[model samples]
Target chain A: MRAMVYRGPYKVRVEEKDIPAIEHPNDAIIRVTRAAICGSDLHLYHGMMPDTRVGTTFGHEFIGVVEKVGGSVHSLSPGDRVMVPFNVYCGSCYFCARGLYSNCHNVNPNATAVGGIYGYSHTTGGYDGGQAEYVRVPFADVGPSLIPDWLDDEDALLMTDALATGYFGAQLGDIVEGDTVVVFGAGPVGLFAAKSAWLMGAGRVIVIDQLEYRLEKARTFAHAETFNYNEYDDIVVEMKKTTDYLGADVVIDAVGAEADGNFLQHVTAAKLKLQGGSPIALNWAIDAVRKGGNVSVVGAYGPIFSAVKFGDAVNKGLTLRMNQCPVKRQWPRLLEHIRNGHLKPNDIVTHRIPLEHIAEGYHMFSAKLDNCIKPLIVPNAR
Target chain B: MPSTPYVSNKPKNTETREELRARIPGWGADLDPADRPSYPKERLDPSATGAHWDFPERQAGAEGREHSIEHEIVPPVFGTSVPLKGFSGAIRRHAYASYSEGRAAHWLLLILGDRVDAWESHLRSLASLRPDNPVTETGVLSERRRHGIASRFGVKRSDINHQWIDPLIVGAPWVAAGGAAVVVVRKLVRRR
Candidate 1:
C-alpha cells in the first residue's frame, strides 16, 4: 500500500508500506478514497509536535470504504462507505458517555493528557492515519460516520475535520441573535466560523487575516466584513471602532501554533519551540472582543505553556472555551447544512492530487501556492 | 540445482533458563529486568503458590518470581479502583527479563502506576534498583491487582507477601491518588 511517510521536518514522501491491519477487537481497516492535507498537519510537517517519530505517516482527514471490521465492530461491514474523524475514541468510557468523545479514556495509552488522534503523532496516540491506500481505524463503532448519499465525497471528507471544527468553533462562541462577531484568521476554520456565525444569527461578522487570498475567501464565502491586520496599525482598535467602540460580541481564534504577527512571540514560541504555540490569534481574539464576551478557540496547538494575556482576559471577564472539536458531534447539523445546499464544503478545496504526489501537495499547501485554501488527495486515483 | 539448507552457527546453550540467566551480570539477586520475563506457567501463577522443583520449600522460590507488565486498560478487563481517565489502549509494548534468583521466605510488594508515564516509570524504577531498594521491593506491579500497585494504586498491608514494612511516598501522579506501597513483607504464607 502506498502511504505518506514523514521523513523529518518539511519532508514527506508517498512510499509503499504495508496496509495496516486490525490491532484490537474494535478496529476496522478502510480502503481510503479521499484524504486532505490539513492546516494542523503543517504543524507536524514543520516539526512543531513532540515525539513525532520518523517513518510515521501524517494524514488524518480522510474518507474511505470499510474493507474489514474486527470481531466487536457490528455497526460497520466491508464496503460500507465511511468518513473517519481524526479522533480515535472508545464509546463506553466516562468522557465518551458525557459527549466528550475526543478525550476518550480507552483509546490512547497517553490518555492522561491528549486523547487519541489518528496520524497526528505519538502525543495523540500512535495510530496510523488515512493518508494511504489503506488505514486502520480503532473504535470503529464510535468515530467513523457513514457518509450520506446526498453528500459530495469532497464535502464528506472536509467534515472529517475542517468543516466540523469550524462549526464547532462557532458552536463554542455561543453567538446570540443579532450579535456582532469578530473572527481572527481567514483560514478554513475561520471562514467556516464566520459563515456559521451568520447561520447562528450574528448581525455582523468581521474576519481578520494578513493573507489577501484567504481574506478574499472570507468575504466571498463567509459573507463577512474583512480586515488585514497588517493594514491596520492596531487591529483590536479597528475592531472596536467598527463595532461602536464596544468591540465585537464574540471572537474566535482559528489560528493556533504558527500564528504570525508578534515577531518576538512567534520567534520564541513557534520558531524556538519555547511555548506550546504563539497564542497570537488567541490574544488577538481576547483584545478584539467586547469585555464579558465569548471567545472560542479551535486552533491546533501542542500542550505546553504559552505567553497568553490571561490577565487581560480575566479583567475583561471573557468566557473562554476551547477543545479539540469533538468532530462527530457537529456532523449531524453539518450534514443537514450540506444537504440543504447552505454549505458546499468543497468550495474551499483549491487543489486535487493523487496520493503519490502528496509531498508536492504538502509543499504547495505549505507555500500557499496558487491561492490554495485546501487541497484534497485522491488515494484511489486510477 | 538443489540449494543447500542454510544453517549458520549462533551459540546454542544446553543450560536451563535459570542457569543461563544466572550467568548474566547482576543475576542471582533480587532485581527484576526491564522487560517481560519468559517463565514457565507453573512458577508465577498466584493460584499455584507451591514452590517449583527448583525450590525445596513452599516459599523458597518466591523471590525468583517473574512479573509480566500488562496494561490495566479502560473498559478495563478487570474492575480496579484506579480512575480511568484519558486515552488508554495505544501503548508501547515491551518484553522484560527478571534478574533475581535467590528464594526468600518473605516477599516485599511495591505498587506503582500513572496513565501516560506508567510504563516508562516502571522500567525506570526497575533500573534504579540497588541494595537500598532491592528487587524484592520493586518486583514490578501488574494489572491483575494481586496485591500489585499498578492496578488498584493502593497496596494494603495484608496484600504484601510477608510482613508489612513502612510505606514510601513517591512524588508521582500516582502519589496524589494516595497510593502508598508496603516496601517490606517479613511473614511468609505457605501454600503447601
Candidate 2:
C-alpha cells in the first residue's frame, strides 16, 4: 500500500508500505476514499508537536470503505461504507459512558491527557492516520458510523474532524438566544463556529482574521460580519465597540498555538518555544468577552504553560470551556443539520489533491498559497 | 424577513418529513431507532453491557508488554499497536520499568526513545532503493526558491529562532553516515 510517509519538518512523500492488519478482534481495516489535511496537522508538519516521529503519517479526517473486519465487529461488515472519527476509543470506558469519547481511558498508554487520535504524533497514541490507501481502526464498533446514504463522501470526510469540531466549539459556548458571539480566526473551524452560532440562536456572529481571503470566506460561507484584524490598530477595542462597549456575549478562540498578532507573544511562544503555543488569540478571547460570559476554545494547544490572562478572567467572572471535540458525540445533530440544508460542510473544500502529491498539498496549505481553505486527499485517486 | 430563531418552539425546518425524504437522498434511512447502531447503547442499560465478570479477561501475551511502574498490573485493555522493539524499545522499557510516570526523567527518556526510533527508521530506509532525500525532504531548497530566508527575517514564524541549528540537526547524521560508508568502501578497495 502507498502511504504518506513523514520525512521531516515541511516534508512528506508517497511511499510503499504494508497494508495494516487487524491486531485486535475489535479492529477493522478501512480502505480510505477521502481524507483531509486538518489545520492542526500543520503543528506536526512544522515540528511544533513533540514526538512527531519521521515515517509516521499525518491525517485525522477521513471516510472509507470497510475492507475487512475482525470477528467481534458486528455493526459493520466488509464493504460497509463508514466515516471513522479521528478518535480511537473503547466504547465502554468511564469517559465514553458520559459521551466524552475524546477522553477515553482504555485506548492510550498516555491516558493522562488525551485519548488516541489517528495519525497524530506519539503524544496522541501513535495510531497511524487515514492519509493512506488503507488504515487500521481500533474499537471500530465505537468510533465509526455508517455514512448516511444522503451524505456526500466529502461531507462525511469533513465530519470526521473539521465540521464536527466547529459545531462542538459552538456547543461548548452555550449560546443563548440573541447573544452576540465573536469567533477568532476564519479557518474552517472558525467559519463553522460562526455558522453554528446562528443555529444555536446567536443574534449576531462576528469572525476575525488577518487574511482577507479567509475573511471573505467568513462573510460568504458563514454569513457573518468579518473583521480584518490587520486593518485595525486595536481589534479587541473594535470588537467591544461593535458589541456596544460591553464586549461580545460569547467569544470563540478558533486560532491556537500558531497565532500571529502580538510580536512579543508570537516570539516567545512560537519562535523561541518558551511557551506551549502563542496565547494571543486566547488572551483576546478572555479580554473580548463580556463579564460573566462564556469563552469557548476549540483551538489545539500543547500541554504547557501559556501566558493566559487568568487574573483578568477571574476578575471578569468568565466561564472558560474547552476540550478536544468528541467527534462522534456531535454526529446525531449534525446529521440532522445536513439533511435539512442548514449546513453544507463540503462547500468549504477548495482543493482535492491526490495522495501522491501530498507534499505539495502540505506546502501549499502551510504557506497559505492559492487561496486554499481546505485540501482533501483522495488516497485512491488515479 | 428575519429568519426564524432556532430556539423558538417552532421547528426550524418547515418542510414535512415526507418532503425532506423526497428532497434529500436517503434522508430518513436511519430515522428509525432500530436502524441506528448506537440505539441500544443509548438506552443506558448497565445490565446489557454483556460483561458477566467483574473484570474483563486479561488479554493473552501481556508478559513482555511495557507498563508504567505505577501499575501493579496492566490495565484490562491497552493498545497493542506499535509494540516495543529494537534499541529504542529497550530504552522505552527501561523508562517504564525504572521511573514513575510523574517523573520528567521518564517522559524525557520516552521522547529520546522516539527520536532514536525515528533515526532507526531513517537508517533502515537508507538500505532501500528509495533513501530519504535530506535536501528536498528537509525543505532546504525552499529557503532559496520560495523566499524561505526572506519569510523568516520579518515573519513571526515560531521556528525561526532555531533556524540556524536546523541544517546541522538535519544534515549532520547523513554527512557522518556518508563519511563512514566511504571509509568502509576505501578499505575494501585497498584490500582488492
TM for every model, in the order presented, reads: 0.68, 0.81
lDDT of each candidate versus the true structure: 0.64, 0.75
Task: Kindly provide the TM-score of model 1 when superposed on the true structure, using C-alpha atoms.
Answer: 0.68
Worst 10 residues of 2 chain A by lDDT: A104-113
How well is each residue in A1-382 modelled by candidate 1, as lDDT tens digits?
A: 9988765455566667877766566678999999988999988776667545455687889999999997777678999999988877665555665566677655554334567888886556656777889888876777787887878899889998898888778777877655678888888888887877766656677898877778889988877789888777788889877765677789999999888777776666554556678888899889988878999999888755688999999999999988887777677667766776667788898888888767667766654555668988888774
The alpha-carbon lDDT assigned to residue B128 of candidate 2 equals 89
* Model 2 C-alpha lDDT per residue in residues A1-382, reported as the tens digit of each score: 9898787656678888889877767788999999999999987776666556677887899899999997777678999999999888776766666666787666665435777899887667667898999999877767899999989999999999999889878777877656788999899999988888776666678999877778889888887889887678888999877765778888999999878788788766654545668899999999999888999999998655689989999999999988898788678878988887878998899899998778777776776655779999999886
Q: What is the lDDT of candidate 1?
A: 0.64
Model 2 bad stretches (over 4 Å): B1-128, B135-192
Q: Give the TM-score of candidate 2.
A: 0.81
